[model samples]
Target: MSVEGNPGRRLLDEDRLFSSDPSQRSVARRLYAEIRDLPIVSPHGHTDPRWFADNEAFENPAKLFVTPDHYVFRMLYSQGIPLESLGVARRDGGPVESDPRKVWRLLAENYGLFRGTPSRLWLDHALSEVFGVQERLSAANADAVYDQVQACLDKPEYRPRALFDRFKIEVIATTESPLDPLESHARVRDSDWDGRVITAYRPDPVVDPEYEDFTANLEQLAEMTGETTSGWKGYLAALQQRRGFFAEMGATSTDHGHPSAATADLDPAACQSLLDRALSGAITAEDAELFRAQMLTEMARMSLEDGLVMQIHPGSFRSHNQKLMAGFGRDMGADIPTRTDYVRALRPLLSRFGNEPGLDVILFTLDETSYSRELAPLAGHYPILKLGPAWWFYDSPEGMLRYRRSVTETAGFYNTVGFNDDTRAFLSIPARHDVARRIDCAYLAELVCDHRLDEDEALEVAVDLTYNLVKKAYRL
Candidate 1:
C-alpha cells in the first residue's frame, strides 16, 4: 500500500492539544496561529554540542530517536526489554545490540507503550514534521519508516546545524560540567556556522560531596583554574574562575540538580570545616547534604559576582536503581521524584539574596503540591527568584496547563520564564516547544473566554510566553 493510504499515516488534527469547547477552541486557534512560527529560544537543555561542532549527519533512526532518549527507553525497559538489547551500552564494555534496524524494529513493535503519552506526541510530531514521514511507527512499517528517516538524515538539509535553522531556533543552550574543557563549544564558536549554540554551567560533580570522584574532581578544578582547592576559600575561587570561563564561552546560566532545595549561609569557619571533611572523605550523609546546601548559597553569591543566572531543580532521587546504576551509569531514567520542601529549605538563601535586585534565581520542582502553596508565593515575593516552567516529568500538555493555572494567580505571568524543551533528543526540541505553545494558547483562550484577559492582551502574552520571556529570563 502507498504511504498516504495507510491509516496510521494520518497526521494529528490542527486543534489536537487545544480545549474541546467550541468557543475556547476557536480562541485557542487564533492565539496559536499568531505565535506558532516564532523563533524558539531554548535556553536550557542537554543536547550534545558535538553534533553542531562536527556538523555531521545523524547516523541512523534508532541512534537518533531511541538510544539517546531515556524517555523512549524507559518505557521500553518498563515492559521487560533490557536496556542492552535496545542499544544502550553497558559500563563494562559488554556487547549489546549493534544493528540500528533491529533497535528500530523493537521500538516500533512496542510503540503502543507510548500511547496517550507525551513521548508519543513528540515522536509523532518529529516523524511527521521533521522527517516528513507520514506513516506511524509500527512493526509492520518499521523498515519502511526507518529507511525514510535515514534518507532524510542523510540529506544535507537534515544535518544538525541545518535543522537548527529549519526549526527556527534563535538560540540553544547545552549543559556542561565545570570539569569539561568545552572543546566542542570552542569549535562551534570558532566555526562560521552562526547557529548560536551556547553552554550552561552545571557544577554538580565538584560541589556535592557524595558525587563520585568528588575529591578528584576538585583536584582537576584546581589544575584547570590554578587555584588551591585544598581550602574552602581557594575551592570557591576555582569555581568562580570556571564560571568566568563559561561566561566567556557564551554561557548565561548555571544549573544545579541537587537532591533537595536546601541552602545554607554558614560562616567561613563552619564552611571550611565542612570542606575539610568533604576533602578527607569522612563527611557524614548529613554533612554531605550540608555541604551541598552551603554550595547553593556559594553558587548564588558567585552568580551575583559573575551575572550567571542560577537555576535550581531539586527533589530528584537520582539513580534510584542500584542495578541500573551499576550497569548503565547515570541518566538512564532511574531518577525518581521525591517529596520536596521549598518553604523552609530556600529561606536561608532567599533571606540572604532575596533583596538583591541584580541576582536571578529560577526555581523548579518535581513536587506539584508546592506550586501554589510554596513556589508561587515565594516567586511572587522574592525580587531575585522566578518560577521555571513545568519541568522534567511535568513538561506535558496537561502539565503545562496545571502549572499556569496553579502558579499564575499568585506569581503572575511575568514571574515565570517561558518554555524550555529541556530534552537531550535533538528532534524532540521543536516538538516539545510546540507542545508548550499550544498549551499556553489554550490557557490564554480560556482566560479570554472568562473575560480575564482581552484578545489583544492574550496575543501579546502568547508572544511573550513563546519568545520574549525566555530571551529576557536567560539573558540570551
Candidate 2:
C-alpha cells in the first residue's frame, strides 16, 4: 500500500509545521514521531459512503479535488474563476465544462490563489503524497499532472476502499439527514470489506423550519418512519424513529448545523403552535429561529436517551450567495460564518443538560472571540460540554495554534475533543489531520519549553489530542 516518495520533489516539507526554534522544533518532532502514524478516527465528516459501498475508482482529479470541495472552488471562485469553468454542474442542467482536464488546469493555473491558505497545503499534499506528481502543479504541467492522476484513478489500488485502508482510517462517519435512506451506509455495513463507515444523524432537513422542502421533508420522515407528523409529539416520535434507524446503521452521533447556538425549552402548546405555522409555511423568521433553537434542546434530550454524542456546529449563514444559490444550489462554497453568540444562546440547552453525566455535547464556534471568553469557560465548567477542534474558516496552522492558546489555559486538553477534518474533500482528510497533529505537537513543545508541562506529560497529551480524545468524546 506504499507509494514511493518523489524524494526531492515532495511538495510538503518534512518538518512542515514544527516550531522554527531549534530546541522547540526538536521537541515537536520527537512528540510527533510517536503519534503521526496513529489510525485516523474520523468520527465526524461528509465523505460519501457509497464510495466504500461501491468501491469504485475515483473518476478524475478535477472531480475528486475541485468540483465537490467548497474549500478549493471558493478560492478559485473568489479569484473570478467561474465554477462552471471548473466543471461545477449547474442545477438546471445548463452547460458547464465537460472536460476534466480543463477543470484541473484551472486549479493548477490559479494555484497561487491558494498560496497562503490551507487549501494550498492540502492540494499539494494530495498531489505529491497521494499521486506522486513529484513537482509543483502549474499551468505548464497541468495536463501532465492531470494525466498522471487519471492514470492512478484507473488503477485498483487507488479505489475508495483501497485508499481508505491506505489512509489508515480506523472509522469514518458520514453525515446524513434523518430523511435519507442510508442505503449507501447499509451497503458498506452489509459488505464483507470491513472498512468501518458509519452515519451521523443530521436532522436539519426535518428540524429546521426554514430548511428547503420543509413540509415535504416532514412528510417523507413521517412516511419513512411510520409515525405521524400532525402534532408536535408525533413529529418528535417520527424524528426519534429515524434516529433509531440511523443508530442501527451504525451511527454514534447526531450533528446539528444550525445558524446559531440558540436553544429554547418550550411548553408543548407553544411547540405545537410553532409546528403548525412551520408546516403551513407561515412561520415568521423569528419563529423559525425559535423552532430551530428548541429542536437543539430536544435533540440533546434524545442524545441523552440514545447515547448518541451530540455535535452542535452553529453560526454558519448558509447559502450566502443569492445568485449562485439560485443557479448552482447550496454548498457551492457560499456558506459564510456569521458573528455568533454562545453564552446566552446556549443557556437554555445548557441549563437543562449542562451537568448531565451521560450527555456528551461537543460545541463548535465559527466565532473565535468566544474561545477563551465563552466556549472554554463553558466547557471548562460544564460536565456535558467539550470544545470541538478549531473549525471551518480557522482550521489552518495559525488557526489551530490560536485555538490551543485560547482554550487550553481554561478548558484544558481533556475538555476538548481531538480534531475532525469536517471536509467534503475526501483526499484532504489525512492532510487536515496531519496538520492538526503537527500544530498540537508544536504547541505541546512550547509548554515543555516554558516548563508549564513536563516533556513526558506533553507527549501523553499529544497522543490524546491526536487520537484518543476524539475516540472517547465521539464514542467512535
Which predicted model would earn the best TM-score?
1
Give the per-residue lDDT of model 1 (tens digit) for 1-476.
54434555466668889999999999999999999999999999999999999999999999999999999999999999999999999999999999999999999999999999999999999998887667677889888888888888889999999999999999999999999999999999999989999999999999999999999999999999999998988999999999999999999999999999999999999999999999999999999999999999999999998899999999999999999999999999999999999999999998899899889999999999999999999999999999999999998988888999999999999999999988999999999999999999999999999999999999999999999988889998
Off by over 4 Å in 1: 6-9
Query: What's the lDDT for all of these models?
Result: 0.94, 0.92
lDDT, residue 195, model 1: 93
lDDT of 2 at 290: 98
lDDT of model 1 at residue 318?
99
Q: What TM-score number comes out for model 1? A: 0.99
TM-scores of the models, in the given order?
A: 0.99, 0.98
Ten consecutive residues with minimal summed lDDT in candidate 2?
A: 1-10
CA RMSD for every model?
A: 1.1, 2.1
Q: Give the clashing residue pairs of candidate 1, or none.
A: none
Question: Per-residue error at 385 for model 2, in Å?
Answer: 0.2
Instruction: For residue 183, give model 1's deviation from the true position in Å.
Output: 0.6
